[model samples]
Target chain A: MKRKEQKTFIAAFLLPPLLLYALFVLWPAVNAFRYSLTRWDGLGSATWVGLYNFRNILARSSEFMPALEHNVFLMVVPGIITLSLALFFAYVIHQRIRGARLFRIAFFFPNIISSVAVALLWVLIYSASDVGLLNNLLRLINPKHEMIAFAESSRLLWALVPMIVWSGTGFYMVLFLAAMENIPDSFYEAARLDGAGSFALFRKVTLPLMWDVLTTGIIFLVIGGLKIFDVIWVMENGRPTTTTHTMATLMYSKVFEEYNIGYGTAIAVLLFILVLLATMVSFRLLRRERLEY
Target chain B: MQRMLGGAGSGLKYAILVLYLLAVVFPMVWVLYTSAKSTQEIYQNPFGLPAAVTAPSAKTLETPIENFEKAWVGSHFSSYFVNSVKLVSISLVLILLLGAMAAYVLARFEFRGKGLVYYLFLSGLLIPMQLILIPLFFQFSDMGEALTRLLGPITERLGLGYLTVSLHDSHPGLILIYVAASLPFTVFVLTSFFRTLPGELREAAMIDGASEYRIFFSVMMPLGKPGLVTVAIFNFLGLWNEYLFGLVFLNSDHLKTLPLGLASISMQAQYKSDFGLLFAGLVIAMVPTLLVYMFLQERLTKGITVGALKG
Candidate 1:
């Protein structure tokens, strides 16, 4: 192909997608910063408020702080539960247990459904009414037992612990399993011959080899935890109180519901920074020299 | 030959796997059954059959699909279902076409600023959509109004009605955002995929006097089917289940997607004793995904692992 022709082809191929991406994603991302700085309600023109919005959100108000705390709790709690369960399941499945394929498929079932559906399913289970599955089970176990209002705003975060873990473990399990599969059979064989027990072989060989993938999984968990909205949004019936609000939900409700565009974008800006920092910090804290076989 | 792990260890493994599997699947199964039950039966026999045993041999049974009927026809999930299908399919097509075009270029050519442009797309993978949501709404609406003004005369002449392109609260607008949001990951996956294909195929096609466009459409695309399918399935499922963008950008009731519709139904279920209807809605929202997973389980798992592992 001629040099000029090649250039034109590249230009033609790249321009449309890049243009759409910039207009929708990149440009708006930059605009998020500008909007965060102004006092606009997303309608009439706004005055520049400088750092007032950020200061008010980060310092002045108790609301944003509690929301941030909830986000952190969500990140740490579900992150621990999901990763541990995923790692354990991945290891056991890696053992080629009976019906391992069926187990793998079943474990990943929740990942196939939408987040909203998962939340709704859990809500039904946790409902305090006669139709509620958990409540019904409790009622059957003991006649004196009362139905728990598990879906209330105050208790929603605790409720979300199991919901998030249940849906998330399979994806990470598949992730770690894929990584584990890449380790040579010779390594495991060598370890076994050296009298390394099952746990020892996993610890000595599997863990180090799969560190990169595990880091990626952790990063995925952290980012996902921080941005969580749908589960809390649906489970709370789209009316998140202070007790249940995460940063993403708070940002959405503030901007769209309250029309506080500036304040909401401020939350967005903080969320962006927080995700970046958490990802970076996780990578740093988990970093080790890679071991090659 | 299998090495002998103790029977105790094997039993423990089976026990753990079965336990977790039950924990995972029981909710969905329970919801399926509950969706079939009448409201009264739901209250009386929460975990039992949908029929009441009035005598030793005779039982009264309610139609299992009553809840589905109520949620679909009565509650208007049918319309929302159509809207979701429209949005997801249109977005899937655009993402694949545009994503393939860009991925092909990035994989095959050496151009100035290629590295920078590649990283630009890569950076998008990390940036949260939450940051862009506020500005995106306003921008789309403004663009819609501008397009309406620009195309007003032509559209009127063409009998396309007041043909304006205001994307806000419309199918096209939602599709545009979905395509953009999915592009980064799609491009990343496909570019790596394209690079792995031997260049000799393109060289062979060039010797036959095939134009670049022909090369792309006929040769490259066919060769890249697995990668394309993987990316397409991932994007399709993601867009189908997407709630945040649809919830915020679309305001009209009829324009809402399944996730948004299900959410609205859930909120309304708070005051209404429509748990059966809600369960039916859950099952409706879930069927397509479950069906896709059942048939394409390999592709779905492989697609996810491909993207995550590559990252």
Candidate 2:
């Protein structure tokens, strides 16, 4: 193909997507930015408020700060925990042990199930009364003093943490496992011949090599942690005085419950900005080229 | 003594692994078990197995199947199912085709505004669905009007008004929206794999007088199966659990997908507190996604490992 022909072909190839993307994605994002500046109930012409929407959310709304805290909590805590557990288990399975495939499948099963289902299941296990599975089990073992309502308490984090780890660790594990699996066999064999034991091999060869994959997993978890909506949405809808409210859930509440579209959009806009900043930082920190074997 | 301690530590690792797996798997197991039990049995002793090998007897099982039957027989899941499958399938195909083509252009060619073109795609990477969703809804709702103002006049003259297209609330609406929503990850993943392909092969094909379209279809696409299948399965699963978009875009009960349908039922049953029926609905909603994961775990793993970077 000549240069002009190649240019023509490229333009033809790109035009449809570019056009659709502009109409659907870029245009709408622009609309959302405009919406963030206005007070629009679904029924009316939106009233322009400029930055009042941002001001009120930053200052007044009861849901805003708690939700921001939960998102940041998710960012700092489960974000790290999930990645660590995923890497550890991926390393374990990468040891070429028997039933490694089973472990991989078992761990990944939770990510496949909807958060609504997982939250509901944990609601059963963490039920507040003797009727719940955990309480019932506790009764059998210890004749417990009191049944705990895990989802409804301030200490809901304890309950939420397990589910967060359970559901997420698997998906990330598969990435690390895939990366670890792709590690040439020669690397391990060389380490073994050098009299390095399993722990030494992991600390030196495995950890360093899987760094890019591990970093990728952390980046995913950080951004996912920030915008987590459904899991919290499903699990009591940020109940118990908004203790479990993530940034996304708080945004939902402001829009749906309080009928504050402007405030909600502001929250949404802030979340979009936060996600962008975090991803960029993670990329900069983690973008070293993967060392080829 | 040291060896025994080491053996014990190894044993502890297995125990921990088994326990974690059990913790996650048990809830799914318990829900299925209870679905076979009567409503009274659930409240009476959920931890225990059925007193006998019981079925969905009133004494043993509890399902809103009767309620669902009323909804479906009156409203019909057939339309909902057809609508859902049509929406998901059409959108999946569109994303795969356009995304792969665009990715090939980006990956293979060096051109003016390359960085801008690439960032335009990359910008979609960090965008939260909810962030862009509200505006996309406004745009799509007025999509027909927008088209008319832009190209609809020309198409009007061309008599392709016979092909008047607005995929909103209808099956095609769901398809169009999903295609747009899923485009970024698909483009990103396809580009990653596309970049890995040897450009020399395409050049050699060019020397043989093969058209770009022919090279794309006959060569690039065939060899890009891993990336293509990866995106297809992913777009399928992502669209499947999709609740917010389905809820907002498709307004009719008859056209609601299983996730949306279950959500509608559960929301109504909220005050009734019908835990048994709700669990059953949750179980029902989960089965299709679970089956996909079971069958296509490899594809899912591949897709997400690439999509993970978009994070």
Candidate 3:
């Protein structure tokens, strides 16, 4: 009876937070799931479309598969490069080398920036004109080939690629850096004396141990990759045949701009499921007993 | 021989680090330079330094005077700014105070459905903002309309002219969204900070007859300064650059925040590129964040690493 009463007592204190959170977040979350089932605009009756909304995106829309391919391509190449760079930078800094604090701050500053702002900056950088940063730099060095950063569709892809990679490397660096610091130094010291060189030491020790954090980073990048709407949305606003379009931007264009609520919700719901599945998989596979060493 | 190679390798490593740093920092410097230059000169020489800061000098600056002045004076940018500051400040303070208090209750005291409550908050961290935006907008609209209707009847009953409460464009409306979006991470972050506090510290305070409120306000609040600073800065930047919600919520031209304001006014000529005004506006819009970052440079790193990584 005492235990039950104590539980009730604690429940009273926890009530307010739970109520507010559910009312705002959980309620909306239910609405998101529900709305995905219905064909609704910003107004009017939501028709019960059943599995059609899901089916439309999965099997119907022409942009669906190509955009998925683009998002997946975005996820793998830049994702792997940035994660490895972050891990490397973190490892170096965690070694307590000189100017570690400064390096960390310089790297992590980009995380605070809005993706819209970064997109704006990178647009200028990749401008097809000679005023663009990369083309000018290229002109300055070689003065040959007049590299078209944003002229051709393929060129635009290559142009925006650097911005995506450049902006995100710092965020993952901070994550891995933290994980590295949490690893016991005694293990590192012992590994050092065992005649393990830098790459060998990292491969055997750091990567295996920080696997949990790495998986977490990968999952984050995957979801983040799929949700690549805002930056792309700001730059060109899903323009020129929608070649650069991802699922997120496609949803936005169809729904808000084109007023295709049914199709947009269909895409948004697909992204949510795909992201959710990726996160669940990462969590399931990567979790292990906490090896506190 | 291996030692010699290791020495060369370390030297190469330094070279790579310097190259990486230059790559990141160079574009930022270009922004600073471009912000000072005139449009005429930008076309002729993209790489030249600014001859003057403001005009009427040896060299002229060539952005539209109207845009910068418009941002500062014409538009209620000052008012919109205050709205943003007040919204962020009030929301963060409330979240920190209430969040830390609730975190204390969860961490120190025995609680029912605690794990469930914890996961309830944790699940929020996974939810990206794009998903729930539609439902939230509907809720906000409904609440706003309901408040307006209530205010109308009350005013009429008193025989006064009806002054409808337009909660839609009000400061409180923005604050509501900010709080909802920010509370999850703030709670997660402060909970960790709270758990690190020694249990005896609070218990001993309790023996001294300190109330829960007092223990929280007096003891826990002050010690959690670092964590508070971290959360505060993150909240500041997040709210500052937040456009999607701001775009949806704020409709009046006079009520526009910096980001939306810049986005609307800066681009012209039927999409004719005005890199000059755009860069100037971008620089101006980016200033508060840059300044905040420069100040919280070290603390921000520690906070994000600790706050975000554990999840």
Candidate 4:
């Protein structure tokens, strides 16, 4: 192709997507910074409030602070359980135990469903009435046992622990399993030849070789934990209070529901910063020298 | 003694895996059963199977299928399902075409500001899209009027009356947002995929006087089918299940997607003792994705691993 034609072709190819992306994505992203500085409801004129939104957000008593705390709690509490269980399952599956394929598929089934649907499933499972599985089980175990309102906003975060872990563990397990599959069988053979027990072999051979993917998995968990909204939103029936709010939920309710455009944009900005910082910190904290085979 | 110990260890591993599997599937099984039961039956025997013969009446016997029918027709999930299908299909096509074109350019060309453009696309992956939610809403609100004004004259000249296009609370509005949000990751993946394809074929096509567009469409895109399919499936699954964008942009009842529709029913069911309908709605919402995942498990899993493990 001639130079002019080639340039035209390139422009033809790149311009459409780049234009749409910039208009919808990049422009709004940049505009979010400006929106953060103004106190405006979405419908009305935005005023120059400077840093007041940020100030209120950072104050101890603001809903944003507690929301952040909930996010952090989710990050730490579920993070550890999810990673550990995922690694365990991945390792077990790697061992080629009987029915491993069935377990893998069964576990991953939930990951394929919509987050909203998953939340609804959990809402049923935790329903305070007779339809609740947990409550029914409780009633069976003790005839007079009162049904627990597990889906209520006050208990919503704790209720999320199982739902998050259940839906999440399988993906990470499969990720690590894929990475494990790539590790040459000779390495495990060598470890066994060296008299390494199964536990010792895993710790020595499996974990080190799978470290890179595991780090990626952890980073994914962190990002996902911070961005959690749909589950909480659906579970709380789209009315999450401060106790159950994560950053994403808070941003949604504030801006969309309350029309606090400036405050919500400020939350969005902080959420972006938090996700970036968390990703960076996770990479830094989990960084290890690459193990070349 | 060593054999016994190994047997015990294996037993323990099996137990854990089985326990986890049961934990994973029990909720789905329970919901499925509950969807088949009446509210009275559910309250009376939450764990029991739906009665083999309910009141010996043909009308009330098939509560299982009836609940699903109610959810599909009565709760209006059928429209939501259609809406989700439309949104996902349109967005996936646009995302693939635009993403492939952009990825093809980035992979093959050495243009001015090439690195800058590539990084600009990559940066979209890191910035949590929730950050732009408010601005996005504002932009859509602004564009609603702007588009109407821009198109009004043309429509008037064409004798079609005033043409109005609102980006808020419309299908196209949500489609634009979904395509944009999914673009960064799609581009990043497809670029790397395109780079991996052998350059000899493209060079061969080039030497034969094929135009750049021809080479891209005929030589490259067909060759990049696997990558395109992977990206397509990933985008389909993500955009199909997307909640936030739809929640914010879709205000009308008819435009609600499956997740939104299901959410509304569940919320209403919280007050009303309509767990059967809620369970049925959950099934309606879940079945398509579930079936797709079951059939295309390898591709879906590959798509996920590629995004995460490729660094």
Among the numbered candidates, top DockQ falls to: 1
Question: Which residue pairs show collisions in model 3?
Answer: none
Candidate 2 residue-wise lDDT, A12-48, digit = tens? 9888887777667777777778889999875568899
Residue B309, candidate 4: alpha-carbon lDDT: 83
Candidate 1 segments whose C-alpha is farther than 4 A from its true place: B52-62, B153-165
Global lDDT for candidate 4?
0.86
Q: How close to the true structure is residue B144 of candidate 4, measured as C-alpha lDDT? A: 85
In order, what lDDT does every prediction score?
0.87, 0.74, 0.72, 0.86
The TM-score of the first chain in every model comes to: 0.97, 0.88, 0.87, 0.96
Candidate 1, after superposition: displacement of residue B177 in Å?
0.4
- The full ranking of all candidates by lDDT, starting with the best, is 1, 4, 2, 3
lDDT of 2 by residue, B111-198 (tens): 9998798788878866788787777666665776666577767787897773444556767766666776677778888888899998
Cα DockQ of the candidate 3 complex: 0.44
lDDT of 1 at B257: 87
What's the best-to-worst order under DockQ?
1, 4, 2, 3
TM-score of 2: 0.86
Which candidate tops lDDT?
Answer: 1
Q: Candidate 4 lDDT, tens digit per residue, B1-311?
A: 12122678788878888989889988888877678887888888889887734454666677877788888898899999999999899999899999999999999888898898899999998988798777888788778888888999899999999998888888988888888888898899999999999989988998998988899989899999999988888788788888988888898989999988888888887688787788888888888988898899888888777777864
Model 4 chain B poorest ten-residue lDDT run: B1-10
List TM-scores for all candidates, in order: 0.96, 0.86, 0.89, 0.97
Clashing pairs in 4: none
Better of 1 and 4 by TM-score: 4
Q: Report DockQ per prediction, comma-separated.
A: 0.82, 0.46, 0.44, 0.73
lDDT of 1 by residue, B1-311 (tens): 45435679878777888999999988888988778777777887788866633322233344456678889998889998998888888888899999999999999999899998899998998899899988898888788888889999788989978776767777777787889988999999999999999999999999998988899999999999999998987888788889999887888998888999899998887588877788889989999889989999998999889877766
**lDDT digits (tens) for residues B226-250 of candidate 3:** 8787777667677777777776678
